[model samples]
Target chain A: SAVISQKPSRDICQRGTSLTIQCQVDSQVTMMFWYRQQPGQSLTLIATANQGSEATYESGFVIDKFPISRPNLTFSTLTVSNMSPEDSSIYLCSVDTPPAGVYNEQFFGPGTRLTVL
Target chain B: GIQVEQSPPDLILQEGANSTLRCNFSDSVNNLQWFHQNPWGQLINLFYIPSGTKQNGRLSATTVATERYSLLYISSSQTTDSGVYFCAPTPKAAGNKLTFGGGTRVLVKP
Candidate 1:
């Protein structure tokens, strides 16, 4: 299990503003991901943060709207650019545990709840 | 991309009762995990069973990988168990990327 934490636990922002959420992990991991959960909905994968390279986004998400940065193995950031009412959701960061003869699971961080008005 | 489905979208149980949650996936997966999301929206990992059976305390999980389905059993439920339960399965080629199912919301009454 990994201890992951996110900054700005909860925040309220006006439309057209951007909020950058930071994710820090206690251990070094090779794979980090960002997820979004809309109110009363299932989780959606936003992107996969690649170390020293651009993040790989999912089908519905683009880098321009949700840029990601992974400076090292234990830290990453996801910025929700140009906030809107529809962009309000909980953002989560997760890291993959090592698979050395054990079941590899992704441990999640305490998500950041963002509300845009 | 694999699709995951969970049954009994909502469940109401009295304290001390037992309940079972089911998860069915479209394809064979290398990773299957169960998570409990509390009212405060914190995700707690319950099990990481890709196959066979495993138990912890009053909770147990069984994953029939060949059948592409898994079951989670919670016995002697308590008020603290009231929350949303989610199942995530990752394909063999997808590394650690998880595809989550529509969660089952459980409400335990005192």
Candidate 2:
């Protein structure tokens, strides 16, 4: 298992503004992902951050609206672009199968709580 | 897309009670994970059993891969166990992407 951390535990933003959330893992992992959890809702996969390439976004999500960058194995950033009140949600980062993983359970960061007004 | 159904949308339990939560998925998956999201919203991994049974402390989980369903058992529940429990399955065809269930919200009473 690896220790993970996220920046600015939470934030309050105006509609049409953007927020960039950073995810840092303690060790190198084979997979890194971003998830969105709207208020009173379950988690939804936003994208998969590739180590050296552009992210793979899920349906209903686009690169322009939620651009992701993974420059290496242990760090990735997801920016919610041109945000709106609908973008208010908790953004989470998760890692799976660290280099030395055995059980292969995915672990999550504390998450960044965003409020759009 | 995989359809996941979780039963008993909400749960209320007395201290030291037992409970069972079920998650039914629509397709074959390479992995199924159980997570507990605390009041602070930090998700704690409970199990990674794609099949078979595994136990930790008073919590245990069983996944019947062939049937595309799983069960989570919590015995002698405590107040700290109050939180949202989610089951996320990674489809074999979709690789590592996790599709989550609607979740079972549990509240443990003293």
* Strongest candidate by lDDT: 1
Per-residue alpha-carbon lDDT of candidate 1 for residues A1-117, written as tens digits (9 for 90 to 100): 889999989999999999999999998888899999999998999999999999999999999999999999999999999999999999999888864323477889999999999
* Per-residue accuracy of model 1 over B23-107 as CA lDDT, tens digit each: 9999979879999999988899999999999999999999999999999999999999999999999988776788999999999
Query: How accurate locally is residue B96 in candidate 2, as Cα lDDT from 0 to 100?
Result: 72
Each model's C-alpha lDDT? 0.93, 0.93
| Each prediction's DockQ against the real complex | 0.64, 0.65
Clashing pairs in 2: none
If you assessed candidate 1 against the hidden native complex, which CAPRI class would it receive?
medium
Report the Cα lDDT for residue A87, model 1. 95
lDDT of 2 by residue, A6-116 (tens): 987999999988899999998999889999999999999999998888899989999999999999999999999998999999999999865544336789999999999
